[model samples]
Target: MKKIDRNNLKTFKDFLIVEGEKVNIVFSTAKYDRSFNRNNDEGLKNIESLKVDFNVNEVVYLHQIHSDNVFVFNNNAKEFIEREGDAIVTNKENVIIGAFTADCVPVVLVDEVEGVIAAIHSGWKGTFNSITKKSIEKMIQEYGTRIENIKVYIGPHIRQCCYEVSEELKERFLDKTKIDENELFNGRNLSMERCILEDLRSLKIEEDNIYTINLCTYCEEEIKLFSYRKSVGTYGRLFTFAYKK
Candidate 1:
């Protein structure tokens, strides 16, 4: 993924592009807080402006309760706003589907062959419940997308270097996912990236097809993104969206 000159949104330049298909993965910085939970009017207006700026037909997002729910959006469905879910999958063109996050893992999946895309927000709760796995399953079940055709992009989030969790939560994640303790946990710190990658691998997604931004929301040196864990009082959200047209 490459950051545009504006720096507010980052787009994938050479990944997931196919003949007659325009696929874009957008990653928002701290400047664009597209969270509708507070002051919905401004947020909705910003979304409208984003559609014009990004050249997308529509923007769809969810309320993001940190659950494993994946909302499938077809072309015939109504405009989506503040629907309760943690992920979104769509096969329609020019429609941007996304998930909001502040330090939580933001993942964008695309299958150029099938013209399918998904955006997922997998926090500690969502990861434990296998949200990414469920999102891919939804795409396969609904759109007949092949697991091998999908390309996964794991965006910026709070890394294990600064993400310290309690013993109870750590143990639960280990026991539930059966992920290697050494790979996922460094003493008491947990790697949300590892959990997400492991889940994708279990579904036979090739490692070469996966690209990780590797920018830590808590400690990125170049750009400072929003982080709920490191914020003093108020924190903005980073929007991660995928578009296929």
Candidate 2:
């Protein structure tokens, strides 16, 4: 896969390609706030710029509630509004589906063979509930996506270096993921990456097919990514999306 790194966005080419058809996996930086709730003129203008930049007909974003619900968009005319779920999957073309996040993990899953794509907003709750596995299962059941053919991309988020959680939360995550506490924890700081990797590997997803950007959203400065922890709950969200052409 080819990676195009820019000042405000990161694009992965060929990661979701099939038979010369290409899909762009984009992760926006803080410079481009793509929050879905913004209704100001500037917000509309920003969305318009995104449309022009990606050459997509529509942009479907989620109303994330930190749940494990995965909504499937089948291109129905009435399903045009913001979907209420933490993950979204679709097989339609020309519509870019995205998830909004500040400190939560932004994941994009692509079944290159089936031409199916999914976006997941996985926080502690979503991760504990095995949202990624559910989304993959949904794709397999609904869109004929095979586990072996799926490619996973994990974007920037709060990592273990600074993600200090309570003892109860840490224990719950450890129990759910069944990861060794020593490997998944640095003191009270839990490694979301390790838990996610363990869960993915348990589903028999190949390690090579999984790609992680490995940037910590809470402390990164180069790209100026928004971090919920860093901003104390008042922060602009970063938009990560996948668009196929």
Candidate 3:
């Protein structure tokens, strides 16, 4: 776990977490707009405030096709790439990687020894495709990072109690992977949190090293966490970002 720094936030927020020499976690607790929720300046400002003092290389994001395609940012090619994908890993200390979500989980990874970090978007579709495992695999292959030294954070999002899905979605999970029948749909597995935990345990991410926010975006209006389902389609996005200082 990282120490709490009350001075870094730009507003009244208890959503961000800073850890040791290698990692920081930012959890956004609100939706900034109503029309398709396109306005996210507030969240961006809050995210940027945490970046102060970091070398800050190119930040990474994806169109988030909700697949298992994980990219490694070893070279400068992605600097100009505009396409969206599910995951991104970087070896550069200054590079910050982030992913946006209103309800999806922001799965952050850091290679403590190598200073490599990844910000991942794990919607239900991505989890079915094994996005988490793939990101860990990409880091090891591209940066020689060890899964043991990597610090993992599963930030706030929709939790399982509120994540119940329809019969169609439940069936979809059964058809996709080896995941247990209990994890899926409208109020099922809760997408990001449970799936990330499953991946960590499966990949040996260790229960001790994994940290979670355990927040259900849909349940809390007081904290301001975004909830697409709660907002009934019109919801603004919140960002999850990390950079080296």
TM-score of each: 0.87, 0.87, 0.79
Top candidate, metric lDDT: 1
The model with the greater lDDT, 1 or 2, is: 1
Those runs of model 2 whose alpha carbons end farther than 4 Å from true positions after fitting are 1-21, 32-45, 76-80
Q: What C-alpha lDDT do the candidate models reach, one value each?
A: 0.78, 0.76, 0.67
Q: How good is model 2 by TM-score?
A: 0.87
lDDT of 1 by residue, 1-245 (tens): 23223334333321221122468777776643344322367656766666776688888887778899898886543545557889999888888787777889999889888888899999999988889999999999999999889888888899999999999999998898898899999999999988888888899998788877767888886765888877854547677787875
Error of 1 at 186 (Å): 1.2
Give model 1's TM-score versus the native structure.
0.87
Tens digits of per-residue lDDT for model 2, 153-219: 8888899999999999887877777788889999899887777777788889977788777678899
Q: Candidate 3, residues 1-245: lDDT per residue as tens digits? A: 33223344344243455545656555554544321221356544554554453445455566667777787766564552356687888766666677778777778887778878888888888776778788888888888888789888776677776777767777777666556665533444435455566667788876667766656778965456767888798647766767665
Kindly report which residue stretches of model 3 are placed more than 4 angstroms away from their true locations once superposed: 1-15, 31-58, 75-81, 175-192
